[model samples]
Target: MSRLTQAVVLLLFGGAILRASLTDLYLRYVKEGLRPFLIAAGVLLIAAALATLWYSLREGETPDDHHEHDAPASGAPGDDDGHGQGHHEPRVGWLLILPVLGLLLVAPPALGSFAAGQAGSVSAAPASDSDYPPLPPGDPAPVGLLDYASRALFDDGKSLTGRNLRLTGFITPASDGSPMLARIVLTCCAADGRPIKVGMTGKVPLEVPADAWVEVTGVYSPHRAKDPVNDVDVAYVEVTSWQEVPEPKQPYS
Candidate 1:
């Protein structure tokens, strides 16, 4: 790339690092599909800056010649425009090291237990009708597990007991052979999250391991299950089909 283009690339890469460091939203939502691209762009920018710097230093100068006696005297010190060009090309590249190191050393800690405590699901109240949106015209409306949880809890599981729904989440283990539990990840913070789980009977794919992303289509129903002191009494959501998906870039709680 041209020296000007390389300079712009370095500047933009530095800006991305600064933006990701300064804003939680950028780290969470914006980087979901962008981690590999961002890293590749950073590498390209660094390489271009180094190449430009090398070219600036070597241009118009033979290996055997320093300052020839016949060469015209320069106007003054620092008068060669190209002399200091190498110095600035890398300034932006150097600026990117900070955030890179930060992520490598310590990925910003997961959205914590504290956040989950504060942001308990709105469906916590079973009598609230406002938790659900109007169902579309169909036998089953494919919805997020969070939506199912909110509506189920809103009506004390009355509205969802017989309705078919689809939800996506990662697997969590249960004593039964089938995946009886699942959790959706929230990137930035748990306050904005509502991970919904189900205790359903069916064959969970053996290949779909815990933490593996999966989309599950199922029917929501209320069935009694053993309640643990630590975990809440969960309603069984029957599974019809489960398919694994790629792990998202911004994995979260």
Candidate 2:
């Protein structure tokens, strides 16, 4: 690619990064902690692109003066059979436009039910101990899927015995066509995401579509079953109420 093309590409890429980082869109691909780094990188790229463009334009305006004062030596590395030939960039450099377009024009959505279905195992951290702290104070305390699973499996449902909990996640259908609430856990980015699932029973809407985000108020149920795909323990919840909700700003936890 020519220097002009390189500068343009850098500008577009940096703009796309800024656009995503300045809003919640970046959360779809990366964790929130990386926002500062992304913004800094975008700023640096834009500066570099502007500098390169300025230099290219200045050099273009004074090419004749430089050529008259400092001509290349004969048989130099860049000479082609006694004719001066500039370096040419490979065509592969153009492929970068694909990601630029993808980010700028149509940023991809967060991982959802499809990704949850394809994964064999749910990601859960080992319980630190058999005893867990009591649930926080709330009539319908908000809880994460992983936390509920840990308590259900390791603490024997003691902490969750009578507490009503509220969970927010997208619906992923289980093997028997029952809806299961799920949220993706990301260690770094979407590429490393894994789903944490909770089987939903009692009052689950039969017509809920897969991947629809919902908030369900339920109590932990001792009923547990091994995952069909990975044999890991899957927790259950007896949902008393549920309502479809918009997807959260941060889709992954």
All candidates: TM-score: 0.48, 0.86
lDDT of 1 by residue, 151-242 (tens): 55446665666666666656655545455445534543434554445566564556666666677767766554532423554566667877
lDDT of each residue in 1-253, candidate 2, tens digit only: 6677778899999999999999988999999999999999999999999998798787773423434344456566654534446433347978999999999889688899999888754746556765687788898999888999888877878889888999999998887878888999988899999889999778896788999999999998888877777778898999999999999999998
Model 2: how far residue 47 lies from native, Å: 1.6
Residue 236, candidate 2: Cα error in Å is 0.6
Candidate 1's TM-score reads 0.48
The runs of at least 3 residues in candidate 1 whose Cα sits more than 4 Å from the true structure, single-residue gaps closed, are 1-100, 104-127, 136-140, 153-156, 175-178, 184-195, 226-229, 248-253
Best by TM-score: 2
True-vs-predicted CA distance for residue 129, candidate 1, Å? 3.3
